[model samples]
Target chain A: MGEVKNKQVILKDYITELFKESDMDIVEGAITLELPEGPNEVLLKNLYLSCDPYMRNRMNKILKIEGPATLLVGYVWGFTKWEEYSFVPSSRILFKIEHTDVPLSYYTGILGMPGITAYSGFFEVGLPKKGDKVYVSAASGAVGQLVGQFAKLSGCYVVGSAGSKDKFRFSVFVNTSKSFANNLILHASPPLHLNAYLSTTILQIRYFPEGIDIYFENVGGKTLNAVLLNMRINGRIVVCGMISQYQSAQPEGVTNLKKLITKRIRMQGFVVRDYYPMYPKYLEYVLTKIKEGDIVYVEDIVEGLENGPAALVGLFNGRNVGKQVLLVSRE
Target chain B: MGEVKNKQVILKDYITELFKESDMDIVEGAITLELPEGPNEVLLKNLYLSCDPYMRNRMNKILKIEGPATLLVGYVWGFTKWEEYSFVPSSRILFKIEHTDVPLSYYTGILGMPGITAYSGFFEVGLPKKGDKVYVSAASGAVGQLVGQFAKLSGCYVVGSAGSKDKFRFSVFVNTSKSFANNLILHASPPLHLNAYLSTTILQIRYFPEGIDIYFENVGGKTLNAVLLNMRINGRIVVCGMISQYQSAQPEGVTNLKKLITKRIRMQGFVVRDYYPMYPKYLEYVLTKIKEGDIVYVEDIVEGLENGPAALVGLFNGRNVGKQVLLVSRE
Candidate 1:
């Protein structure tokens, strides 16, 4: 009876396209049923597929694109074309999912890259002190949401920016309600709904009249310039991603950067993969916050694998309200 | 004999001008027959004068500049104008120089604004860590000389840039010969001599091949751009003066400031007067170094008060080799 039930299931796995437009190809392959023979390589079913702005770089052929996945390209010397699959040989890339009582989709959003990114970026790079005013760009997105919550926990005056009015309202509401780690997001400050472009500039001037001490910069270009002007002396800018200029043929020129000298600002760019050492501790803290209802986890889940194209493309346009994730399978 | 000596002295009192082009009016005043009864207001006969780049700001009748006496430009709000005979307003500008063991000329250079600027900027702001790379612009000048020495004492790799080839060689000689507490300027690289236009930029690049950990920036403009590009992660740039842009109609726009983001650079402009609390300690430490021959002091002593004008103006043109000090009442 068990063999019959297993055979009838016919497990369907999520497969991402190698190239876009006319060259797009999706692999129809069976899910690997092989279990871990040893301590290494825990077979993850990838129940919730993380759809990030950075992943857009991985979708195209490496030579033609640049971003987080370029990390893999540096090691992989030559690839003829993006045909069948992209495999990265690593001693460890997959980790066993322990203590999985909460929603599995949490792994794709808060519990994964986004969570650890906020953790390292806020503490290690941003260096947020108690009572510091922090401004996070793309506040409703995966990394941005967690960073805003973390700032609140760090005893900072946290103000966030999102593209749509709905997402901005939702983020403020979620944070104020203590959806993420019982940390208080100020209920006051009359609903900060701003256009993504004007929001980047106005939030800097309005929210940070004295100037922003820390900026978790996900969207770059004019946002960076505005932040540069609105930065306090010794302000810290953590360059998580430049999503705004990612699709452009040429990187946008930032003119007002000389303000860094007058303001004594410190800015740095980093990738979460570089800081894997803190992942275990980060996972423990984040998951605890989730289970205790101290940290609220939100995911804009696309129900099926077929909608991956629209969801992935929508990242640039700030379409997702929360972490844009695809529910591929149920473990 | 006392009366004859007093008459022979020709008590030449000076009054500083409120505007730049105004002559420093010298008044023929009678000498005091007896010492005035006062506690800490020992009358100092105008002896030697220090001409500095900072003093140019004081020459202009602009907004109230908040810095050393040399940099302060207002309506002679606190200071006795050029060639003006006046008593020190004890409460107004504190620490009126009393009986000094050293030459009163030292007050204008080593013991005055530039001296404290060097002491405060190098130790307090630069925060020279052991084995850190240090770069100083305007090496032969007052602040640059002391900063280089301080870096050496901190067990840092120090390199300095001067305008003249002679000054460059002299700094190298001083770096090697000095035995101050921190006199350990590592001769890992060649000394840099910069041209007027590309001076700051090329000097920054050459001095900090691995990128400067601390930059004592005296000349701003293209140099700032170079320093921005060549700064290591967490590098500190102390903007003491913007000599390059001081006379320009508009400040030269520095373009390469985007490097600050990637490098996590910190650039700060400071006035040495903010560090009055450490004056006594700085005086003691520097005097000790001078007395022990551990730190070598150099001055461009232009003889005759008539030559003072050329000496003072030479600073902006990079014509003055060392501290531009004029001999009035010579030893």
Candidate 2:
């Protein structure tokens, strides 16, 4: 391995306001493609990089940053840019690609961290039983789509809410512009009118008439508040992400938390890193689902490292149609 | 058994605004002190009545009312007034008075619903470990006091916040007036300056240097938001009650819910009815603690049924120094 010209997306400055593409600087840098002499060091050509919502949280200075530059390829190493040909610690790579028949890019989205997130969040946290009424927010995205499919596989009546109608098979397509108005109505009204607005709650009740047993929380904010209203007794709210509130100057205040007590709801948040040990089992299950055509994944691939900054920022704006991925190289 | 003059306190109307003493009507009524001809009917002289925060939720017609008039006393029977003698179902009496060595009023506080709430919320939901940092809000209240004691017994470092200086041995005495100002400062600042205000977060950090492992959430609103800022990784927030917001026309919005995802926090709410099966064990455990003098319970007893309405209303006003109970008649 030799030093190579690496086209990189550098975080020139921490984003103080809502994320803009200009916040990232695309710079031409050189990297020695050889692993440093250490017991736990791995060298690999970056094939596919994932654009996740949680990556936005890292842009803020409050959260702790840990691990090598290329470790998770996205979350860790605050200064690590969208670069080509980087070296990372061997331990970071939880598993090596064994099944080459599938697209290697699948490792970044459907078969990687997001896959484990969907698996653990849905099965362990959500605790969906047969005939359980399940509701998932941001249902077209990386994790939500899998969560909905997983619920369907468990004989649950799964309803998904997405930003647009064309993204995926969403039960409710929430128009982002109208959603703010819906949120205002849901928050202002004390008696939670089911017919007042086409809010997440009304749509949820319309789809799952019996009320939501398990809520796979991805978008958070108004969706979370709406779900809180429609949750059944002893309902489970698996808090995966709050993507909607990440960019706001002041995060929205959740007023309907009292419903948690009345409904005996368990709202829990978990990270994929904690559930990494079960990756092998999850991989097998997800691979089988893909092979059987029971699961389908959509990826919005943006070519070249220079376009990575735009693709990453596009996530906050809900610009991408599916799991936004930056194709660094074909490998 | 004959008909007797019963001085009753009837809810004049459903209170949509903050609860006031005027909302209740003291009426002269009569009740036959005889058991009805039914297998599951029990006619007993109402001895001690409990004034709990949950009763406020019932005042709003949104929450479901289950069982006959006297079960949990105030929460059920929308029309059940603050009365002297009442007819109730036999099954409603969850426990028979096994030990008379303690005050019968203990059945309303330490030996009753609040006792179970503390035990289960702390042990089952909070899941505190040895050396864990525990913080309880409304620390001198029925449930909060016990939760602190229980945390201490489990070899955990416990800190409690109370509204007044005289209420029990609170680790931090949060002056209610100053607390409101502190809450304003805390909410206004996004960066969270440690020295800006002696807010719940600062007081919490002063008590638990390592951050909070378990937060026994008896008082929500501002305290909850402050606790959210200082929660340790994988922290447990047992959602017992939000007494601060129960009376308000609009509940406060919790702005720091993003902390849930960052810290992988678990916030769960449970009612005592769900954990009734654990009553025997909790009873034995609490009784032993009382006998050993490891736990000390204080009750603010208002004598006579006429004072019941005033005492119940006093709970909202923070007039009661301890567990507010009404003495209906001597055993």
Q: What lDDT score belongs to each candidate, Candidate 1 first?
A: 0.59, 0.71
> How many steric overlaps does candidate 2 have?
0
Predicted chain B of candidate 2, TM-score versus the true chain B: 0.84
Question: Per-residue CA lDDT of candidate 2, range A226-304, in tens?
Answer: 7787889999999999887888778778888988887889999998889988988998898988888777787788888
Task: Candidate 2: give its CA RMSD in angstroms.
Answer: 7.2
Give the docking tier of candidate 2: medium
lDDT of 1 at B175: 42
Residue-wise lDDT of candidate 2 within B1-331, one digit each (tens)?
6889987777766778677878777889898876588788655566677887778777876654321122233222111335666665556544666777888787777888788898998999888899888878777777877787888778877777665222322235322231211221112223433222335545545666678899888767777888888889999999999887887777778888988887899999998888879988998898987898777787888888778768777776666756888877775
Residue B107's lDDT in candidate 1: 69
DockQ of each: 0.14, 0.69
The model with the greatest DockQ is 2
Best by TM-score: 2
